[model samples]
Target chain A: MNKLVNQINDLLLQSIPSSPLETNLEESMRYSLEAGGKRIRPVLLIETLKMLSKSDNYEKGIQTALALEMVHTYSLIHDDLPAMDNDDYRRGKLTNHKVYGEWKALLAGDALLTKAFHLISTDGSIDAQTRIKLVELLSDASGHLGMIGGQTLDMESENQNISLETLQHIHKEKTGALLTFAIMAAVTIVQPSDDVSELLEDYSQHLGLIFQIKDDLLDVYGDEDKLGKPVGSDEKNHKNTYVTLLGQDKTEQKLDYHVKQAEKCLEKLREASYDTSQLEYLTQLFYQRDH
Target chain B: MNKLVNQINDLLLQSIPSSPLETNLEESMRYSLEAGGKRIRPVLLIETLKMLSKSDNYEKGIQTALALEMVHTYSLIHDDLPAMDNDDYRRGKLTNHKVYGEWKALLAGDALLTKAFHLISTDGSIDAQTRIKLVELLSDASGHLGMIGGQTLDMESENQNISLETLQHIHKEKTGALLTFAIMAAVTIVQPSDDVSELLEDYSQHLGLIFQIKDDLLDVYGDEDKLGKPVGSDEKNHKNTYVTLLGQDKTEQKLDYHVKQAEKCLEKLREASYDTSQLEYLTQLFYQRDH
Candidate 1:
């Protein structure tokens, strides 16, 4: 939505290693990392920091962005593994293991996931303590009580109809936790006022919920080419989704309501501190996107 | 060998989780982590920190010890995956996948590895920056230029005789890096004198080599019950080892030489502020242990 965000994304792609020893590893990581999904989490982080303070610690934000992407990509890579979702394709290409063979793909996922914290902690520009906090934020996001926990629930819920609360619990941890971290990381680094931090948390939580609901809706109705994976995948796997539980009309209404709530929270921030327009653009892009 | 070291080990065992959602994940982790290895790396770290300053930082050292063990255990979990070494057993129990199914086992390893950094960074007692440095030390030991790189090479060299130089390179990263990190973490946290830190590195490097050679020796001469895994598994896999490359006698001779070198370095620090005797005892144990 902004030149700064685009520049950060470009720098990220260039900075990640293209090593020979693990060519497939690098390729698979890059494939999904570069796949044209909205760089929302990273953008949210960088923008949140910008809104809170004007500083050159943007490098820390960039590292956080990249690290978040690594975690996201690794989850996608592993989620596509045979024993997991058993998906043959992702983003219109063969999944990592299918292309690289199971072993290297597995190692590549492991490598990317492990390397994420390394990237964040080892970046020289950030203060060491800040870097450590970033790692803490991320590790908590990805560990058992967070993304991994959400994934475990998701795996168990496949082919089985689950209650609304169980579904909410799964999506919140699986998808929302990292998004919350993305927002919180920036807030923590800037050491913003508690009210602003709390407001951002509310905004992030609403946006996160909207994100998953939109995803569920897309699986039911979005075009395959734009989505970059097969449509109806969740249904094929007998997976329960928000749309499955609430129906399309209710899901669409819910998405609209959450987007309004997110925007309402954004109104609490000082108008001079952030280009509220960028966030508005992002929220609109998120909820309205077909993919 | 000391009472304190034993107490630390007990704490480590008690701290690990055994929740029902990840029962086998916990058990698989405990399989290698709880298997009664020498616990040399963590003890070396604690002793090294104490040697630098007998301050109230032993708790930090204990947390670092647990973190390092988590990294070590994570490696073993992945290494034994079907895509990697595919071993059916580790220590005396079934390998991670054999016990928990492959996918969950893989996630268990990922969770354990990721949780390690969280444990250190969020320990609350240590400074965040110091925690960041500790993570850097760990990632450097375990990432591309470190343990994982070493593993990549080792996997590539399987069934093929590798040159001694290559083998040394492999062992340095694969085995020595973490050992070096164990020492370096303490040094970083305690801000040990340069002389002590450098000496500890020298001592740990040799200790690592001695440990590997002893591992090779075990494969050839160790008992299944004592070794906890089948002896000659390496030979069955047609993997080259120091015992095979240099002959059992030469390998033993080399182990003796490394142990002496380690002791010599320890001798240089005999009069340091903290105790070096525990480190010395650990080094001697490396060469003398049967398994």
Candidate 2:
């Protein structure tokens, strides 16, 4: 699975074109896209398809996966902009807009967002109806009431003390929406059983929340070299986090509980005749990641 | 038809929430969205549906039309940013980023762009299948191969000589793609006869080209009070225009030829029992507009 993940990452890197007018926009998009995070979204998509024995869908799945990753990458680019998070570094490299200038960075993000759908729509591997469904799913995940709305909330909460429920709501939309979309879309395209599909959603939401909590914990405790960013950076910004609200010990406990719930959800699927050990591995991996 | 146009314009303004965000992002978006244009795209779409008597489809068509306008408005917003055309004012008000900061302006453009397909997908009036097609059309029109590509060329041609062939390619993608999508999508949804659809395409393309040329002429000879911006703004920016490339006299002649060709195509459609006199009226309206 990891090997296939690397292969998909390579294909994604090769997908963006370099041209004069591209103006480092490609570099900006590629920098974060190729930044060494786990390609979990696309990998899960492919794995879900493979597990369903619908491997013939892999071609469209790959393109859809790439589109999903592009949307995620574009969000990160804009999120790291000076106006947004003001982060100078991400994944041990200068942030995109910092390196590429704001204008090209903006276009780079915009280009990536649009290209995601364009790739899915134009890619001939998917059936026309399936392609359309993919577009609908993607647009929902990317639009105002999804990730962007969460971003609006995240931005709106800057320098203010937001309640834990508010934080959860924000994260649910911000991170959970895309994470849920990744697994659910793959399942939908792969045509899984209802039981399997329900388990996928359950497992994904659990893992998604665990991922965010662990992300919060890692910001306070992880090594800079291993995390690819400075420790306590979130604290330095005085931003809200699970650690800030729940304390490090409680945050750790909450993350553990979510991971366990995610694993247990997978266990139910294991008995229902799907090969879900890879999902278990993925859930564990998300819980353990630093950056 | 005019009443429907006004209703759409009003509904569009009411549909968009005017609220404070991290900055004036919402305001910047609303500024361009609410700016009084002719609602030409929406009018064309509604009229197209009216001709087809697909009033049952009007609900989706109206939303799609609004989405189209949003895409169009976002283009204008980004085009007016400092890194693009650098215009301080548009439609007699500060450009998006001018009233809001650059960051908000960029995000507002993004929000509007992403919301377009969101509107289409979530609208219950349209089947998910048709929503998908609309997404494909809008995404292709907005992507790097379309409007963005044209924008790159336009920026590249600043203060440089551009051939008529190159100009056509740029305008076709930049301006004509959305216009073509407008008519094509309606016909596709209405399931019109192939001959009628093809005629509409020809009519739209020719009229779109004429519209571009008239815009060039207007920039050089329009009234500021009427045009909502200073005349000769294009020349002042050292931007290439049809008038500059073909000379004013020839450009005017070209515009007349295309407008007549557009009308002629519409005449064929009428003879085919399409009763598309509204489209003919739209073509003449664009050709005759001073601004």
Candidate 3:
């Protein structure tokens, strides 16, 4: 996993070359991308590809993985803008808007998002049909009906007493859509059997829930040093999170339930004669991460 | 042209379906899109396709045309954000941020941008290869090296004395790249010969310059009512426009030069046995528009 993370990091650095144009837009884009995260989405994409194909040659999936990371990073940059979440620090560094000023940061995020599709479209290794399919899936997952919709709901739900169902719906679109895209992109690449694909999708959904529930859990109880931001921001913002909807104990139970469900999906995949070890490890990482 | 505009308007209305999600994101996206503009970009695309292909069955180009309009509309929304131009009005109506609030407007722009690629990728009437090529071209034209890069330079050059070369470069990227994309996308769809494609590319660049130079001129001397905003706001913002750098007479000369150049390209296309009347009309429209 560490090796895969290093590989993803190296590729990201090379993703956006310094433009000869007289603008710091590229710099602003590179700044947020280089501010390291766990690379969880990309890693999941590559690992899913490798596990399903029974081959370590995951080279074909690299562009899609990088595209996924770019989308995630762009969202973070936009989310931290003053008009949005107004966050100053993310992952222990000044947010893109903090360092680049609001306007440039905003353009940088736009550029990064645009570049994600460009990367996939220009990946010469992939056939045109697959690339088109990836673009379709990605836009569906990240556009108005998916991540943006979830974000809209999340923003409106702030300071309001929201139901647990509403909270789940928000997370499902806001974050889960992208995570599911990560796994499904791999599935799209490998063309796995319908049963395997269905099982993998179910597993990804559970994983997305576990990931968000853990995020809510961490904000309340995890170490701020590890998380790289202050804890209890959810409460401070009056945001309704899983932890707020369901108390700490209940959140933990919910997290455990997802973890078990994820494992069950993996169990089905394993019985189908596919190696699920890498994905199993990923489930555990999402389940147990401190940040 | 009026007929084409109406067709584009009706399709834009149908482009974003109401999502089942509990959010007003689709409404926000549709608001700015439905807000009337000249629909110049998409019209250029469709007209270019018809001229090059000599086929009035432009149904093949409708989706791409709508996609082009979405990209244009998204840029306007983001450009009008409080963190950017901070504009209160566009097209005589409240800017997107003013209508939907800042965050939702931002997300709406993001969603519109993403949907552009989705529309192209899912365009089943076009071949997979053609769709992929369009995606590649659109992203390059609209991404970091193109539109976004131009915007960054424009923002940085505010209140500063900039060279003609620098100013032209800024407009070329900021406004010109996507305009070029408008024409070039049609060439891609029609699969024109190399010579014709080259000529069209030159024509589009000159057309782009004409568009921007006329924009500068309009901001200085045009009717505020026709423009749907106050004139001379560019000067108030301390922008280094063509009118500012070259003065009114020389700026008009520059616009005339590009108009002649664009006509020359169309003339060559005419000699090469392609109908150039539509393109000539577009060139005149760009050159003489009051707004």
Give TM-scores of chain A for all candidates.
Answer: 0.91, 0.92, 0.98
lDDT of 3 at A265: 96
TM-score, candidate number 3: 0.98
For every model shown, what is its TM-score relative to the native structure? 0.93, 0.91, 0.98
Per DockQ, what order, best first? 3, 1, 2
Instruction: Compare the candidates by lDDT and give the number of the best one.
Output: 3
lDDT of 2 by residue, B1-291 (tens): 677778887877766675432334465677778875888887888787777763434765888889889988888887777766778887777788777776667677887887786677666776666777777778877776677767766776778877888888889978988888888778866877888878888988997898899999999988878887778878888888898888899999999899889888877877777667777788878988987
lDDT by candidate, in order shown: 0.79, 0.78, 0.92
Candidate 2 displacement at residue A115 in angstroms: 1.9
Categorize the docking of model 2.
Answer: acceptable
Off by over 4 Å in 3: none
Against the native chain B, what TM-score does each candidate's chain B reach? 0.90, 0.93, 0.98
**Model 1 residue A119 CA deviation in Å:** 1.8
Query: Would you list the clashing residue pairs of candidate 1?
Result: A129-B129, B51-B274
Candidate 2 per-residue C-alpha lDDT over A33-116 given as tens digits, one digit per residue, 9 for 90 to 100: 787477778887777777666343476578888988999988888888766777888777787877877656667778789888
DockQ for every model, please. Answer: 0.56, 0.41, 0.90
Q: Give the CA lDDT, 0 to 100, for residue B221 in model 1.
A: 95
lDDT of 2 at A190: 74
Instruction: Rank by TM-score, highest first.
Output: 3, 1, 2
lDDT of 1 by residue, B1-291 (tens): 467668766776676676434424455556556654567778778877877776545877888888888888888888888878888876666777887788777787888888888888887878877888888788778876678777777777788988887888879888989999998988888886788878888887898898888988999899887877778988898887997789888887888888889888877887664567767767767777877
Q: What is the Cα-based lDDT of residue B256 in candidate 1?
A: 84
